[model samples]
Target: MAAVRVEVSVLPDSVLLQILALLPPWDRLRAAGVCRRWRRLALDRAVWKHVDLSQRRLSSGSLWQLLRRVLPAGLSTLRARGCLLSASRQRLLSPALLSALGKRCPQLRCLALSETDLRRIPYASVPASLTALELRRCELPISWFHPMAPSGTLRRLLLHHVPAFADWHLMAASCQHPLRVLSLRGTHRVTEAGLLQAAPQLKGLRHLELWGCGAGDATMGAIGSHMKQLRVLEVVDCPVSSAGLGPLKSLQGLERLCLELGEKVAPKAVIALAQALPRLRELQIVGACSGMDEIRLSLSHCSCSHSPQAPD
Candidate 1:
């Protein structure tokens, strides 16, 4: 019998691309070296749509180099962290590299970065295509992010443990974009005035979650008054009062309500919420499951002190 000659080199580019997609990012790059055909297939935009560099112990130098080579123009989602940059340099360098990243990946939508300073990132460089952004455990200035894109594009934003995020920042986002969902976890500095100022302006907001915030009347009142289109509201371990819950009656569109209070709170607020939100499909009281239908009220067991928790 004659020896069979099987050659991936002769395979169709589409077929080779399908095979390359199955390999990990590092391995795919290795396969690219096998032949020019493989190199072409590996660099295809579809092959690098979602890139995650959290696993690699990459330095800013190597990260910059990688962005220049591997980052495709049509990338959609990216999660990068693990690069340890000093505060002073991070502010200067991150925005430039991020700008470069956005320029190459114009179609980029979701960007999540941790342990990085995002303050210095130029507003002009932010990708207009972004729909969701999550910044966790970053040291940033107050209202560092603005509406770099046009109206009604960015819908979801999550700020976790970011000290600099205040009323003006939220207001800036509210005024610029029609945000649908917003999450504030471990952000403690935002006082009553900031919350009140920013809350009512989110006309398109549907979902809002506040965790580990002690902001009492100011926070709740804002949600009650301005979050008219809100459907899901989660207030966990906050010092909300019956006085604040007074505004819940105005939220006719509200469907799901998750409320948690410490042992210190009287049952007055809970009773008021139960009465006000008759349309609630899911309800959680003090970390307990009290609703009849399919309800998701996951509560964090925050003790006496929980806000502004450092990221692990």
Candidate 2:
């Protein structure tokens, strides 16, 4: 008997699409040239819903070509990290490209741009349908967050190492956008006063993370007073001491609390936090002092019925 022969073309379109979906973005693009059927399956909306160009060194022309030829209108998430960097002082993400993106990809929901300069790009050029935006180590305009409208769909925002994110931008974001989750790291210019003023306006915020943002007792107090809806809070490398932890006790809705403390915060403060918040489910305390062993022992011996998880 002759040996049986098998071909990928024998597979159903659904199965072929499932196989193609596992390939990398560039690999999928390459696979599209194999055959007409394969091309149609490779360019299916389901296969290109999320495109990550972080690893690729893309120029403006190549990006434009990809947007026009490869990226589907059903694309929801796009992460372009360090893809458009140039040695010369030329903007890779021109207004025309941004406008085309907005018009072409109406379903774009989440966009993340890292290690890219957006100082020249108008804030209004950002896609209006985005529910999440992440900008890391990017040079932003002075009024980046000011153009966001209150009626926009943006819910989550992460700004890492964005030094230009000042109090005015924070205030504008708090007032204009209905953000539910906000993370700020290495934004030292945002003072405690900024938190005091903006915390109240972020009534819908549930998860907040602040790292090296100069938060203190007053900032915590303001959060406890205004941000009653906050469920998860992470404060790392801030100026908050044991005294500052007192205000956090009033956060009845808080479930997960992470604090990276220095010598100023004592072991007992961690115990107090574990016992104070009624809804506290997980408590992570990273002490930079020599009493970390003692802190662990104290936390282990604490009689709080909540039984907070051990620090990670």
* TM-scores of the candidates in the order shown: 0.74, 0.86
lDDT (CA) per prediction: 0.68, 0.79
Worst 10 residues of 2 by lDDT: 303-312
lDDT string for model 1 (1-312, tens) is: 999998866788788778877667788888778777778788887788887765554456666877789888888887766433664533323666777877888989998777666665555566778999888776665535565545646789898887777766776777777789998888887666767777766767899888765467667766777788888887876745557677777777777766665444445445455556656655555443223222222222211112232223
Pairs that collide, model 2: none
Candidate 2 runs further than 4 Å off:
1-11, 83-90, 147-150, 289-312
- Over 90-200, each residue of candidate 2 has an lDDT whose tens digit, in order, gives 445766788899899999999988777787787788888899999887787887777455466779989999878888888888887889999999898898899888988
Q: Judging by TM-score against the true structure, name the best candidate.
A: 2
- Where does model 1 exceed 4 Å of error? 1-24, 31-41, 82-93, 146-152, 262-279, 287-312
